[model samples]
Each structure stands twice: as C-alpha cells, then as structure tokens.
Target: MSAYYDLYETPSPKGREGKKSLHARVCPIKTYTQDEFIKHVAAFQLLPKNQIAGALTAIIDDLCDLLADGYTVEMGDLGFFSTSLKCLQETDDENDKIRAESVTFQNVHLRVSSKFRKRIKHAMKFERVHSLTRKQKKITSTVEERKKRLVSFLKIDICITRKEYIRLTGLTPYEAMKELNDFISQGVLRRRGAGRSVVYVAGENLKVE
Candidate 1:
C-alpha cells in the first residue's frame, strides 16, 4: 500500500513577503501493536503464538544485555546497536582531577544495514491526500487568566497532570509543558514525583482562592 500524505501551508520567514508554499506531510493511518505483530508472524510461519512471543522476548532481553555489556549487536540485515557516552568538561585547576562521576551514559546509536535500507527505498511509494484548509488559530487566555484558573483548580484538586493541563487549557502537549515550566519558574507551581508519575502542585508562593 502507498503511504498517504496531506499538504500544509508554510509560514513565510521574517523579512520575506510572498505567497505561502504548500508542504507534503505524512498522514498516519493506524498503529500496529506488538501483540498483533507476533500473531501475524505466527500465522505466516505456522508456529504457535506462545512460541513466537517467547522467542521475541528472548531476542529483546539478549539484545539489551549485550548492549549493556558494552558490545555492538548486529541483527543480521536489520541494524547494529551500540552505547555511547557523555563526559563532563575538564577543570582548569592544576589540582582538579577527573573521577567516575564525571562520565555518564549517553544513548544507544543504531546503524541500519545496507540491505534493509535498500529494501525500504525500493518498496516505499507515496500518495497525495486531499489538501486541508488552514483554520484560524485559537486565542488562548492571557497568563493572568490562566494563572487564576490554575490557582482555582489547585484549591480544589491540589494537583494536575500534563494531560489534565492540556484538557483544562485546550493547549497542545508542548504548549502545556511550556506553561507549566513558566509556572515553576515563577514560583507559582512545583512538580512532584518524576517521569510518568509526575504531577504539579501549588508552589510556596501561590495564594489559592
């Protein structure tokens, strides 16, 4: 099946005055989950679902273990996985010395095999979808208005999630994060917990009504 795309108008850069140009952007159809993938592969290979699932799990465990052991894993024609590191800057002082704390793990870099890259390059096809009309951007409430609303909500709920902030203010995830970060910087809100369990609470400076 051909990949589908939609067109969007690009905003003119500063100091440039001309007609806006259209850009083609991919329109995702749907997502295929891991379980569905295992089932599909089992059907084609004539193997039991449990066997295929176990093998896939083992492969992932081994790959992670190998990467953690400072080894580059080559998965046939798929790709290679290897870890990288980031180190702290050196001090200028003659007595200053580098320690284990100065180094940190960065990320796992992937290098795709030429065969897999060639296969995708030859098979991929694109289809243009109907162009979408640009809608006027919604005007969000002023900072003061948002702060008042947030304070009011905190008075009753005590805490809010990234998702809750989006629902409350009709803001995208990135915009919601920016507003939350601003609140934290202004001493109006403080974050609790970390990662997915994180939530926002009223800061010491906040005077909730």
Candidate 2:
C-alpha cells in the first residue's frame, strides 16, 4: 500500500517574515501490532511464536538496561542505539550558568544504518490524503471516554505504549502523555521500562473504581 500524506503550512523561517511554506506529513491509516510482528518473525525464522516472544522480551529488557548504562549498542545493519540530552531551559546567552543537574535526557536515539535507510527509502510510495486540522485530530474523545476505552483495551491486551494510546484515543502527544502519567499516579496504570523503552500496563486501580 502507498504511504499516505497530507500537506500543511508553516511560517517561513527568520527573514522570510509573514510568508508561509507548505510541508508534507505522513497520515498513517493503520498501526501494526506486536502480534503481527511476532508472527512475521516466527514464520521467517521457523520458530514458535511463544519462543520468539520470550526471546524478544529478554532482548528488550537487556536493551533497556544497556542503554541506561550509557552503552551504544550496534545492531549490525539495522541501527545503533544511544541516548540524547537537552537542557531544561536554554542559557541566557551562553554566558548563563547551566549545570549537569539542569540537563536531562530527551530520549534514546536510533541512528539507522545506511542499509536500513536505503531499504525503506527505495520501497516507499506516497499518496496525498486530505488533511485535518491539529485541533480536529486532537479532540476526538472526552476524558471519560478515553479512560473507559483504555481500561477496556487493557482487559484484552497485555500492555500499551504511548503511541498506541494516542492512536486509540486520538489525543495529541502531550495530552496523551499527561493523561497516562496521571493514570499511573492514580493507580489506574503502571509504567514499565525507561526512556524509549516505556510501556503501560494495568495497575491496582485498573477497574477505575
């Protein structure tokens, strides 16, 4: 299937004041689940799904630990994994004080190998789709509705990632993350892993009573 995209306008940079420029962004229509990935790998490697899943889990656990320890993991032609950092706030003018305590990791960074980039770059096909306003996409469900849907999903699924929650609830990234953190705080969900390896599972208050 062709990758779908939509166009949006952004203000032109610096000197081009008041001018707008158009840019294209992907419009994903579907999300593949972990089940699909496991099935594909199992078939390709002639392994049982359960075995593949178990190994995958262990690999992820190790990746999280290794990345936390500040190791750059090289995964052959796929990519290398490392951490990235950013300041909480910029220095006043490079003369202002900015200590180590004021800096924090933004997330884990994956630098895809040349082979990996070439594979996708050669295979991608694009088609334009209608664009929706950011506000329109971000305001799909009410707070209660999102909470209900999430609880119901966790009843059948094992866990959810922030991306999955955003897709399920049509929430903006910031809004979805805030609500997820709030749910964790309220004991409705619990976070697993750190940085890029994070996921959420049902907590003591999963029933939301």
Candidate 3:
C-alpha cells in the first residue's frame, strides 16, 4: 500500500533481482511550500472557493502571528507548534530578563492522531511529486557529510562482510547496516545484496569520513 516514507531504502545487493524495488518507506519527512499549501487546501472537502481560501489563509496567518508573538500554538491532537529563538538578549534591569531577539522556524512538530494521519497518508498516495531546492540540497549534503564522517570513524567501509562491519563500527547491527546502505544510495559506498551474503565497501573518501 502507498504511504509517506521518510527514509528511502538503499539498493540491496542480495537479489531476488527484479523481484521487488529495493526502496521502502522507512520514515517520511516533507516541508510544504506556499503552492503545496494551496493545493492541499484545495483538496479539502468541498467548500466554496472563497471560503476555502479564506479559511486556509486564516489558519496560516494565525500560525504565523502566534509564532511572531512568541506563543506556542497547539493544534490539539495534531501537535505542538512553535518558533525557536535564534538569539536572546539580556535586560540590564535588576530583574534578570531574557527576551527572544530573533526567531527561526525549525520544523512543524506534528503528531497527527492515528486516525487522521493514516487517512492523510493514504489519501496523499497519488499526489504529484515535489523536488527539493538547491539550498535544501546543500543542507542535505552537509548533513550527509557529517553522517559519512561518523560512519568512517566508526570504520564503516563497504566490502567488509556485514557481520564484520557491524562488529567494527560499534553500531548495532541495524544502524551499521543503515549507514552502509545510505552510503550506497548516495553513491559513497556500494553494497552487494541482503542477509549473510551482503558486502559493504567504501566508494570514495569524503571529508566527513
């Protein structure tokens, strides 16, 4: 069944080659842009166009205003939403006062109720795809670099038998397995297959590693 996935599976070396696509929805993460928000609202239960637009605009505005005012807006069963302080300033007054000087949005904290999340996930299956921007790509690269470095220090080069890689990397078998798999997807490492026959080997040297 189709559902949102955060992490996509890396190609598995072990094959029932052509048996199934290696990709799996491990975890799904997404950030909505203005256009996406509009499309999402448009998909809501049939409401007059004006009313739907107004309602969505109001909700977004409310969230923005609440965050600007330093209030954590809670969406009941959905989740807690808030802005993070980018910087704080101390008041010279006798009272120790620290005020948020600037704010930055991290990510929306969402905990959709099981029922709602499931419904949304299923409904979103046929939605059109979206691509990440260059800036996002850079940020992702930086994070992956860090992960690779961690993997390297942990000595997670591929070509090693899975068992041996896990033993040396100090990662639980699953984690070591994941790192090696990611490296494969990113073209940093290569994998041979699944289970005991799986082989991992470093594809290249990255600074992080």
Candidate 4:
C-alpha cells in the first residue's frame, strides 16, 4: 500500500496573467476513526477493545492535563508535546505594565521523535491517484441568497445546522461554515449550543422577507 496524491492546477504566485501550475496534494484513501484505531491496537496487543479504548482515552486526558499545567510530555518513540502562546507587545518604557491578560495561549506543538520519524519514513511510499484542474465551478451561493434562504427557513424551522446549510445552498462544508460564521459576525444569525448540537437562529434585529 502507498500514499496517494491528486494533481491540481493552482494559480502560480509569481506567474503572469493566466499562468497556472500543477501541485500534488495528498488524497486520503480512507479515514480511520479512533474506534477503528483502538480495535486495531486491541487485535495486535491481544487485549479487549474496551480496555484498549479506555487506556487510550486515559492517556489523552492525562496528556492534555500535563500540557495545560505547562509540562512537556515525552512519549519516547512518539515524541514530545508542549504548549505555545501569543502575547501582546510590551512597551519599552520602564513604567509600563504587563499583566496576565496580555498573554494569550496558543496550540500544542508536537516534535516527532527520531525513532518514530525513521520508522514511518522507512514504510512511506507515494503514488499519483488523479489529475485535477483549478477550473472547477464555484458552488457557493451569494450572501443575499443565503440570507434570504436562511430567513425563509427560520420562518418554518426554529434553527439550522451546518449540514442543512450545505444541503440548501449546494456549498461545501468549508464554504458553508464560512458563510454561517459571517452571518453570525454580522449579527444576522445567532449560534445556539455547541459542537454537534449547535444550530443557528435569526438574530434579534434580523428582518425577514
């Protein structure tokens, strides 16, 4: 088995006029979920699926806790996990004050161990799956169209999901999310709940057609 990639034509950053270049992007053959991964580990280790899953979950929980507490976690062959932060600029003046609120924490960075890197590198192979052009038609609906549709839906339904917006507007998940978030930011819609249960409702000041 080998990793596969699809060739896509992208606008050349430095090219003149209509010039484009083909770029190879990895194309996933299949997605393996956490449950499937746990089952595979259980099979190899001769342990029950539940036990393997629980152990993996505990490791993740502990890893997050340690990272949150400002500790770097070394998993030997796997690598190290550490937290990072972004901070506001401090004035050079001696009397200037910098408080805890000035610092904003960012994502957890991972440094892959040499052992793990070598192991994966030894097994890696790549193949071209298909060629694609950047000439594909855009499927995103206009903002006015989206707003009208959303308001129309609000008249019949209480709320809408990301998936529902995709279906209604024929937009990809990424595009749908951007449009929805734009609506939220513009005060046209308000988000309710979070995660899978999240839905959108019309804002208090929104006018319906």
Q: Is candidate 1 or candidate 3 better by TM-score?
A: 1
Instruction: lDDT winner between 3 and 4, please give it.
Output: 4
In model 3, which runs have C-alpha deviations exceeding 4 angstroms? Answer: 1-23, 26-44, 86-108, 111-115, 118-209
Clashes of each: 0, 0, 15, 0
Model 3: per-residue lDDT, tens digit, 20-113? 4434343323345665556545555444556766877899899988877778777766766766544344445757654444434455454456
In terms of lDDT, model 3 sits at 0.53
Error of 4 at 134 (Å): 7.6
Q: Put down candidate 4 lDDT per residue, 77-195, tens digits, no spaces.
A: 99999999876875778687777899787899999999999998897777554423334446556778877888888889878988798788886554566677678668888877643
Locate the minimum summed-lDDT window of 10 residues in model 1. Answer: 128-137
Top of the candidates by TM-score = 4
Please, what is the TM-score per model? 0.52, 0.50, 0.34, 0.54
User: In order, what lDDT does every prediction score?
Assistant: 0.79, 0.78, 0.53, 0.76
lDDT of 1 at 107: 96
Model 2, range 3-107, lDDT digits (tens) per residue? 657789876776777657799998764445788679767766789999988988998899999998889999789899999888998756877888889888789
* TM-score result, candidate 4: 0.54
Candidate 1, clashing residue pairs?
A: none
| Tens-digit lDDT track of model 1 for 31-135 | 457897786677667899999999999999999999988899998999998999877866788687768799788998999999999998897777664422434
Model 4 scores a C-alpha lDDT of 0.76
Against the hidden true structure, what lDDT does model 2 obtain? 0.78
